[model samples]
Target: MGDTLIDEPTDLSVRLATVFSQMTRVRTFRLMNSAERGPWPALLKAVFTTPSLTCLEIWESPWRRPEEKFTIEALELPQNYSSLQRFVYRVPFSDCFPRESKSYGRRDRVQGSVELSNLRVLASLICDSVEVLELPAELAFLLTHITYPKLRVFSVQGHEPLQLAEWAEILRSARQLREVHLQTPIGFTEWSKTSSNWIESNSIPTAPVPQTHSDDLIMRGLSNLESLTISNPLDPGKELFFQFLPYANLRTFSLKAFPPLSALGARWSGIHSQVLTSSEILCILKGIQLINLSTFEVSYSVDAEDGVMLSHISSSFPSLEKLEIHRYRSLAKYNSEYDPLVSMPDALATATNLQHLMLNLDFPERPYWRDDNLNPERYKVFHGFLESQVASPFTGAIPSLKTLGILCHDAFSSYWDTWEVSKTRKLVSRPPHAMSN
Candidate 1:
């Protein structure tokens, strides 16, 4: 077998077939943008022949469309499509047809039908449209009938508000689903004054439920989920902000944004008007038993007091081992000595189990402060708490604290230099000692 490696047949189909024949435990097949569409028939033949094959991935570039080259008849798969445990099909924006109104308008109608008929064996499905793709209507119907007993993950990406009712139906069917990612615009209609709730409509409403409420519905469906990542934070409907609390099983959550969080929140009346207070944060924390939660992260552009709201989060999550705060800047108005440093360490000090703490601090420049003033007297109280942990006479400050990272903005880099290295060293070297009154 080793000697055959060099002398293997050069013909692509023959080589693929030979490989399939030789590897008995072949479990994965990944097709890149360059995979020839003309050879799909032969590829399917090889796949059916390989009894151990269970996973297949096809990733096409935005610039190329392998599907365009082959007619449906020429690309038929073997009856063994059901043998696969996982299948993924990705088509980048560049690969999609140009946006002609006639073509774009009907694109979903066309592709939805093909997806339903062809990819019936998938236990797991992921589709992405970076530029923009109109998902076909049949795509919804296809999802409704598929029985993925072992299916646990589903993801779809597109710009248009694809049918969400289909998604609700799919979620209702996917008993084993633990994670779902939707990268498309979610569409819902507001009910007339008589209706108690906004209802899912067949057509996009004149004005859809602000992205906030849509996010709520999506979150509600995935209540039993353990992890979720939503790339377009702006698109999550406003009504769904509190939906996360009920997902007690959640261990990890992530959000990426094209538009700022403020703009996203503006779509929802409740979150936009007020900052998250300590009481509200406490309530959210009280709802979930986070003993199993290992990671929590949120990135938003809000006032300093708003950032302080996170301090309330530390005490409630006792089992939290890793924490991350991103895109956070200090509040400007409370730059004086009277303002607190959010006192996050006070709450964190209680989490003897915490091992990693990551804070991304972005403070704006003020005329009264110099570059070397990042950790000025105002931060003294917070720093005092940190110092006590190092010298912690009782439990030894952050006994499990092995790593601490503080990322500062460039504008404040100069402020760090003003600190006397020797004094700072002595401060940290000294073990925790009870302060004398």
Candidate 2:
């Protein structure tokens, strides 16, 4: 596809119509920045009208703002096109439906809009067939406007806080949803108590939906989830997360501490305290038993008590097969006695069913590589440190363990060295590195 093929040429519409009409077998289409400036009515028409198209992605540059002369596209969608089963639309930096503005005493029209009528038609065509959907939080209104009867996977990334009612409605309508991934903003917001629009639209006079507590609504929505991955800094949201555990039927769960902002204006002192703390993690695994959970990953602040936490996890989830633990801060400043690498293997000794494990930790000491100098002897000592402190201990602790990876990170680079356990009960590096006699 040349730029001229989709760019604003005089015969763009006619050319697109002819070209797309012949693409009868086209199953996926991606419309990006090239189509941001104009509605390209004919191009959109071709996409929605394609009988075999199963996926459609419409995106705009994350940093691109609407131009001064921008006009909202008010094009109508075709009556029916059920072949589309996946849709992804992203406008991370800009609003999807920009509202009208008044500047310099002059009123400006809305920059982007999804008319109600078009949403209705889109629902008829898409809501029934769309099994996977991804959108930015700014366009969450679409969830209320459109009902997804067969949706199974949903993902959303937000630039701001998303209200509770919106979250409830998403799970309410998608009754069969199995997987949900949410990337929330830095700070958490309280879920709103009520939303007249969502309530009245679905409520009936004779038997209105019960006006239960907002927490209950969210709890019911999470009951059927099999896998849930949340990326947040674990602010006030961690309290709400505690409520979700009992109701969720999750088989895979990942809780990542979303990194705090490192921009100049941000405080470096406060940022170090942002990662998940030892107490917070222990609180979660204390009394709760995620029996069905097989795969787990978490990012936490490194401390001496990490080994204790890992032991708790092994006992709590006996069916564990794959596990990954990431240390967000460096161990370079800490003394060797407090090094997690030494105690990690003995800690996870209870996970007898475990087959694979990965640990991402900062180096105990800064390597000379930071100065652009590589010493084979220094690397050998580091390899020996792992063979004795990590690999050798792990080989005897867990009989079922087959593969282990020690990902060491420094200021300069990350090296993921993997060791394969042989039947002779010995650990050998897959890609052998320099070793001392």
TM-score of model 1 relative to the true fold? Answer: 0.53
Q: Residues 251-301, candidate 1, lDDT per residue (tens digit)?
A: 765442312222212211121112233343444455446656767654544
Tens digits of per-residue lDDT for model 2 on 1-437?
A: 21323244547666776777688889998866643343344556656666678988755422222321221243355445467788776443333222231111111123223322233345566777889887654444454546787788887654434545556566677878888876544552332222223333433233233547556766766768887767653544334545665533777777654332212222111322235665567767775678878888776776666777888888888788988777655665753755556677788899989988776665556353412255666667777887777677887988998988876433434445789999987887875222110
How does each model score on TM-score? 0.53, 0.69
What does the lDDT come to for candidate 2? 0.58
The candidate that wins on lDDT is 2
Q: Which residues of candidate 2, in runs, are more than 4 Å off?
A: 1-27, 30-42, 48-51, 58-76, 90-125, 188-210, 213-220, 233-241, 244-248, 259-274, 334-338, 364-392, 406-419, 425-437
Weakest 10 consecutive residues of candidate 1 by summed lDDT: 412-421
Off by over 4 Å in 1: 1-11, 33-39, 60-80, 91-142, 157-164, 183-223, 231-246, 256-292, 328-350, 357-398, 402-437
